[model samples]
Target: MDYYNGHEDFLDRIEKLNAIGIALSSQRNAPALLEMILQGAKSILNADGGTLYLASEDKQHLIFEIIINDSLEIMMGGTTGVSIPFDPLPLYDREGKPNNNMVAAYAAINHKTINIPDAYVAEGFDFSGTRAFDRKTGYRSQSFITVPMQNHESELIGVLQLINAKDPRTGAIIPFSEQSRSLAESLASQAAIALSNNRLIQEFRQLFESFIELMAEAIDVKSPYNGKHCRRVPDLTMMIAEAVCKANYGIFKDFSMTEEELYELKIAGLLHDCGKVTTPVHVIDKATKLQTIFDRIHLIDTRFEVLKRDAEIEFLNQKLAALESGNPQNVPSLEAKFQQKIQQLNSDRTFLQKCNIGGEFMRDDLKERVLQIAKYEWVDTEGKLSPFLNENEVYNLNISRGTLTPEERQIINDHIVVTINMLTKLPYPKNLRRVPEYAGGHHERMDGKGYPKGLTREQMSVPARMMGIADIFEALSSDDRPYKDAKTLTECLQILGKMKQENHIDPDLFDLFVNEKVYLRYAEKYLHEYQIDQVDLTKIPGYTPPAV
Candidate 1:
């Protein structure tokens, strides 16, 4: 019997040795290191309850950190799901002065293990207001063993506490063995080293998020259209990426991206139009068909004055005829004719004011009349007759139609290039290296017609394509737009489908998109109920109503 007992002790010692080795190997990350220690300690001391407390930088009082009991109810004391404020509480001095129960302080200040044989009967221990903790929680005041986790350099890391190490079969708590205390203190030392490394990484990540916010805001404040675009794009981009991941689209099935990568993609979407910072606001918010700074309808007024002068000549000729006939004809008067012509011209120019308010289309002939009334001859502020617009400018002005000029179109396109330039110059995280590529590629067509780099279908990432779609969708459905009323859902989708058919978009992605019902998901989330309610079935060209 004695020989058998000796063999069992040897095996138990080996098991504990392996456990400590496993815990030490977990030095790669702080949280993982702490969890490993908890798991190891639970197995080592055979305790049902365990808690790990990280020391504050100042090593004052120990605060509640992570609890790993089977019930995990200790976290209910209100530390879960909150960022614990980093405040150092005062620690008790070894000479019986009040000291904080922080593991680092206990280990560093006392340089010894704190083992309570019976917490309920312990003298000179402060259980003061924490009695409520025991009463409400049903946690008996029994034995506890705490040790400071430290590194080889004697740096204080954190504190580890094990509660109720019990005598098996008797179901009674027992004080920790000296050997167990030594092993735990050794483990704590290893954990301290891990904690320091983790804190450094966390600080770096926070700094990165701050930079992202500043860059995103700078891009937003630069343009009116892009003002709220940044905020909305990130929200929408992340949602789409999540949906795409859930859909398990091909190679992405096994492709697991980290949270940092996802964040980078979102930032890229937010600053996709950062180049707009260089774009003039006047051009971005241009309201007129041929607008630069101001529409030249005033010049059209000059043409009307010319026409008024011609009418005066004709009126005088009529008066001369009456005089030649020797008939008494009172001249209708010089100023009267001039005033009449001015009144007619003013009426024509002012007739279309309310018409463009809600995008009320003019009759073809009437639109031409409005255009003729606007065609005026005038010198610039420089007193020079500007060079007559060429065919391209005339086409953009679309006198017969109505919309932005071609020069303005190029100016808008240049914003994407600017976006690329601005982002590319900044040193970003590795995952966000593609920010400029994705943002600049938004305007590019799948068929190689896109500007800047003109990346084709295969060159684009899923995120870039999704951002493009989201951007178009938002613009189409935006009721706050100055020119056009928000298009109904059906109208927007049909336009998107047509663009897809024209080889401007990814047909395969579009098919998966409609098949997976991406747009419906987006509509339910971002768009208003009325917008969805107004989706006219008939307006979706070639879409037949399903049989009920």
Candidate 2:
């Protein structure tokens, strides 16, 4: 009967240890996990009070973490509250002369469980001057059980201490039993393993977030106009994506993306313009219709002024000759003609600036004038004018559209190639390895008319197409550029819709975007009052369709 009873008691102890381990594992955060440890130790050992302490990195001290008690009494004169120390409590020297709480420290140092029956009356125990705490509270410190929480590698993580263990039936403070001490040790071991795993996961998440932040900042710093583009796109894209995700109802039944994946997508959206780092800043923020570095239009205006002054000089000389010959009447009409020519030149300069702002849309007639200005030859310091452009000189002069002069187009287009090259150099993990594939294809078209590789719709992934649209949308909606005002949402969508009709962008995504009112969500999140407010969507012709 005694043998059978002992086996059953051993099984009961195992069950309690497993239950406590399961409870400890359920906690996600550090505080809750520590609280579980304290409660489980109190319950397992039938202790009056228990305190869990975390070890400092140096392993020379105990840092009190959590304390559990049934009914705690406050002292009259004690200033420090019953809370654990805000800092680590240092261990004592070699002598056992009632120094600091060496029992807790010893457990952590040795990575072992220590049990002291009747701590106040134990042999070699000296409580001469340190008995003030017990005298004040009228509570005698008795049995103490300290167990080291060690990870799988036997590295000490922390210590757990149980004080004044009680007998459940008699309600009297009893010494900790051998079985209870064993159970506490086993529980501490399991808790340490679970905590180590949590720490590793949290560390990895922080590292990933840090990398994303650094990459976003680097991409923004690439160009002045692109400075705020990376920050705003993620804020806008996430709002739109989350709203659509919520509205899908049953459409997202099979879609099992977590908050983390969505966050990664937002990070990817912010980094979509990282390829622009390879693109020249001057090209990215090109202001004029025929602009590369310095605008020649101002130089052309100076030339026009010189031509008018020369004409005036010629007219004044003729007037002087006519007056000397007694024919001053001929001077009036000649002066009038000179003034008319000057007025015409001023009007033409105004027209060009307006034309430059209007250059967002392609027009054959305006484009011809733009090309004419781009082709104009400027005399170098040698007084020699050059016509044919070398590849390097193209970006040094005027361009008709976008950033690239005809010769610079290939160089600008190679940004995607650079993006592919740079990203492929890193051995990215499986999940993020496709970043290059997505970011590199942002400038590609669906009709095989894009630059570099000129990939068609059949070859592109949905993510690549999404990024392309996001890049364009952010560029259009952004007001950070000094060259052009932000395009109105109505105007932006209409342009994208036209691009879809021309087979340049994906038509399906366009429909999905408009029908779901995706741009409004984006505007609400990232756009300022100037970008979104007081705008009439109806004034935009193709933006608002007929009611039917």
Question: Where's the lowest-lDDT run of ten residues in candidate 2?
Answer: 73-82
lDDT of 1: 0.64
What C-alpha lDDT do the candidate models reach, one value each?
0.64, 0.66
Note the clash tally of each candidate.
Answer: 15, 0
lDDT of 1 by residue, 1-548 (tens): 11212456546855775667655654555555556767677676766677777656766556656665554344311224544454544575557574644433555567567887777777655664446667877767567788876665666666788877755556566776666676666656655655665665678877876776676787666655545666676676676667667655544455555676787788788788777767787777666554556665444445455566666777778778767887644455644765687687667656544333324344567656545544544344476654333334334334332345556668988988888888889887676798887777778788888887878888898778777777777777665555676676777778777878777866655544554566677778767777775554445433332222
Error of 2 at 31 (Å): 6.6
Cα error, candidate 1, residue 436 (Å) = 3.6
How many pairs of residues collide in model 1?
Answer: 15
TM-score of each: 0.70, 0.69
TM-score of 1: 0.70
